[model samples]
Target: MTSLAFLLPIALGMGLCGLAAFFWALKRGQFSDLDGAAARILIDDEEDIHP
Candidate 1:
Protein backbone atom coordinates (compact mmCIF):
# COMPACT_ATOMS: atom_id res chain seq x y z
CA MET A 1 0.00 0.00 0.00
CA THR A 2 2.75 2.44 0.91
CA SER A 3 4.79 1.46 -2.13
CA LEU A 4 2.00 2.50 -4.48
CA ALA A 5 2.11 6.04 -3.15
CA PHE A 6 5.78 6.32 -4.05
CA LEU A 7 5.67 4.33 -7.32
CA LEU A 8 2.65 5.92 -8.98
CA PRO A 9 4.14 9.38 -9.50
CA ILE A 10 7.45 7.96 -10.62
CA ALA A 11 5.73 5.75 -13.18
CA LEU A 12 3.60 8.61 -14.51
CA GLY A 13 6.59 10.91 -14.73
CA MET A 14 8.56 8.40 -16.75
CA GLY A 15 5.61 7.87 -19.09
CA LEU A 16 5.27 11.61 -19.64
CA CYS A 17 8.97 11.92 -20.38
CA GLY A 18 8.73 9.15 -22.99
CA LEU A 19 5.71 10.84 -24.58
CA ALA A 20 7.53 14.19 -24.72
CA ALA A 21 10.53 12.63 -26.42
CA PHE A 22 8.33 11.00 -29.05
CA PHE A 23 6.58 14.29 -29.79
CA TRP A 24 9.90 16.11 -29.99
CA ALA A 25 11.14 13.58 -32.51
CA LEU A 26 7.99 14.04 -34.57
CA LYS A 27 8.43 17.81 -34.67
CA ARG A 28 12.07 17.42 -35.70
CA GLY A 29 11.23 15.29 -38.79
CA GLN A 30 13.03 12.28 -37.37
CA PHE A 31 10.47 9.95 -38.94
CA SER A 32 10.15 11.71 -42.29
CA ASP A 33 12.60 9.48 -44.12
CA LEU A 34 11.36 6.11 -42.88
CA ASP A 35 11.37 4.42 -46.24
CA GLY A 36 14.51 6.14 -47.45
CA ALA A 37 16.61 4.46 -44.79
CA ALA A 38 15.25 1.00 -45.59
CA ALA A 39 15.82 1.53 -49.30
CA ARG A 40 19.25 2.97 -48.74
CA ILE A 41 20.51 -0.35 -47.39
CA LEU A 42 20.01 -1.87 -50.80
CA ILE A 43 22.24 0.72 -52.48
CA ASP A 44 25.99 0.30 -52.45
CA ASP A 45 28.51 2.93 -51.35
CA GLU A 46 31.21 2.50 -53.96
CA GLU A 47 33.34 5.43 -52.92
CA ASP A 48 33.99 4.15 -49.41
CA ILE A 49 35.62 0.93 -50.62
CA HIS A 50 39.38 0.88 -51.22
CA PRO A 51 41.47 -1.61 -53.24
Candidate 2:
Protein backbone atom coordinates (compact mmCIF):
# COMPACT_ATOMS: atom_id res chain seq x y z
CA MET A 1 0.00 0.00 0.00
CA THR A 2 2.78 2.42 0.92
CA SER A 3 4.73 1.71 -2.23
CA LEU A 4 1.67 2.19 -4.35
CA ALA A 5 1.06 5.54 -2.76
CA PHE A 6 4.58 6.60 -3.73
CA LEU A 7 4.61 5.12 -7.22
CA LEU A 8 1.13 5.76 -8.60
CA PRO A 9 1.36 9.53 -8.80
CA ILE A 10 4.82 9.28 -10.37
CA ALA A 11 3.51 6.91 -13.01
CA LEU A 12 0.50 9.08 -13.79
CA GLY A 13 2.62 12.20 -13.94
CA MET A 14 5.01 10.59 -16.37
CA GLY A 15 2.13 9.42 -18.55
CA LEU A 16 0.59 12.88 -18.61
CA CYS A 17 3.92 14.46 -19.53
CA GLY A 18 4.30 12.06 -22.45
CA LEU A 19 0.76 12.82 -23.59
CA ALA A 20 1.41 16.55 -23.40
CA ALA A 21 4.56 16.23 -25.49
CA PHE A 22 2.74 14.14 -28.08
CA PHE A 23 -0.05 16.70 -28.32
CA TRP A 24 2.47 19.50 -28.62
CA ALA A 25 4.09 17.74 -31.54
CA LEU A 26 0.70 17.07 -33.07
CA LYS A 27 -0.18 20.76 -32.90
CA ARG A 28 3.05 21.52 -34.72
CA GLY A 29 3.77 20.21 -38.21
CA GLN A 30 6.10 17.48 -37.04
CA PHE A 31 4.01 14.60 -38.34
CA SER A 32 2.70 16.31 -41.47
CA ASP A 33 5.27 14.78 -43.88
CA LEU A 34 5.12 11.09 -43.11
CA ASP A 35 5.24 9.90 -46.71
CA GLY A 36 7.88 12.35 -47.81
CA ALA A 37 10.22 11.23 -45.04
CA ALA A 38 10.19 7.66 -46.32
CA ALA A 39 10.87 8.80 -49.87
CA ARG A 40 13.46 11.36 -48.82
CA ILE A 41 15.96 8.82 -47.52
CA LEU A 42 16.15 7.10 -50.93
CA ILE A 43 17.51 10.26 -52.51
CA ASP A 44 21.27 10.56 -52.95
CA ASP A 45 22.53 14.13 -52.88
CA GLU A 46 26.21 13.28 -52.63
CA GLU A 47 28.52 14.84 -55.19
CA ASP A 48 32.02 13.76 -56.16
CA ILE A 49 34.73 15.48 -54.16
CA HIS A 50 37.32 17.38 -56.20
CA PRO A 51 40.85 16.29 -55.32
Candidate 3:
Protein backbone atom coordinates (compact mmCIF):
# COMPACT_ATOMS: atom_id res chain seq x y z
CA MET A 1 0.00 0.00 0.00
CA THR A 2 2.84 2.37 0.81
CA SER A 3 4.23 1.94 -2.69
CA LEU A 4 1.07 3.53 -4.04
CA ALA A 5 2.20 6.83 -2.56
CA PHE A 6 5.02 7.00 -5.08
CA LEU A 7 3.72 4.99 -7.98
CA LEU A 8 0.15 6.23 -8.27
CA PRO A 9 0.93 9.91 -8.51
CA ILE A 10 3.78 9.32 -10.92
CA ALA A 11 1.59 7.26 -13.18
CA LEU A 12 -1.22 9.82 -13.04
CA GLY A 13 1.18 12.66 -13.78
CA MET A 14 2.63 10.87 -16.77
CA GLY A 15 -0.81 10.10 -18.15
CA LEU A 16 -1.90 13.71 -17.76
CA CYS A 17 1.29 14.93 -19.40
CA GLY A 18 0.77 12.61 -22.33
CA LEU A 19 -2.80 13.81 -22.80
CA ALA A 20 -1.69 17.43 -22.59
CA ALA A 21 0.98 16.88 -25.19
CA PHE A 22 -1.48 15.20 -27.52
CA PHE A 23 -3.92 18.06 -27.14
CA TRP A 24 -1.20 20.65 -27.67
CA ALA A 25 -0.05 18.89 -30.81
CA LEU A 26 -3.61 18.78 -32.11
CA LYS A 27 -4.03 22.50 -31.54
CA ARG A 28 -0.72 23.40 -33.17
CA GLY A 29 -1.38 21.56 -36.44
CA GLN A 30 1.29 18.96 -35.71
CA PHE A 31 -0.89 16.23 -37.27
CA SER A 32 -2.49 18.26 -40.04
CA ASP A 33 -0.53 16.75 -42.89
CA LEU A 34 0.24 13.05 -42.54
CA ASP A 35 1.33 12.31 -46.06
CA GLY A 36 3.35 15.36 -47.07
CA ALA A 37 6.54 14.10 -45.51
CA ALA A 38 6.35 10.77 -47.34
CA ALA A 39 5.67 12.55 -50.62
CA ARG A 40 8.54 14.94 -49.98
CA ILE A 41 10.97 12.04 -49.62
CA LEU A 42 10.01 10.63 -53.01
CA ILE A 43 10.67 13.91 -54.82
CA ASP A 44 14.24 14.62 -55.82
CA ASP A 45 15.68 17.83 -54.49
CA GLU A 46 17.89 19.26 -57.19
CA GLU A 47 18.77 22.29 -55.10
CA ASP A 48 20.55 20.22 -52.49
CA ILE A 49 24.33 20.56 -52.38
CA HIS A 50 26.37 17.74 -50.90
CA PRO A 51 30.07 17.39 -50.33
Which lDDT tens digits does candidate 1 get at residues 1-51? 999999999999999999999999999999999999999999988888965
Candidate 1 vs 3: which has more lDDT = 1
TM-score of 3: 0.81
- lDDT string for model 2 (1-51, tens) is 999999999999999999999999999978998999899888876673443
The estimated TM-scores of all candidates read 0.88, 0.83, 0.81
Q: Model 3, range 1-51, lDDT digits (tens) per residue?
A: 889998999999999999999999999999999999879889976778553
Instruction: Assess the local accuracy of residue 9 in candidate 2 as a C-alpha lDDT between 0 and 100.
Output: 100
Q: What are the lDDT scores of the predictions, listed in order?
A: 0.96, 0.92, 0.93
Better of 2 and 3 by lDDT: 3
Models, CA RMSD each? 1.1, 1.9, 2.0
Off by over 4 Å in 1: none
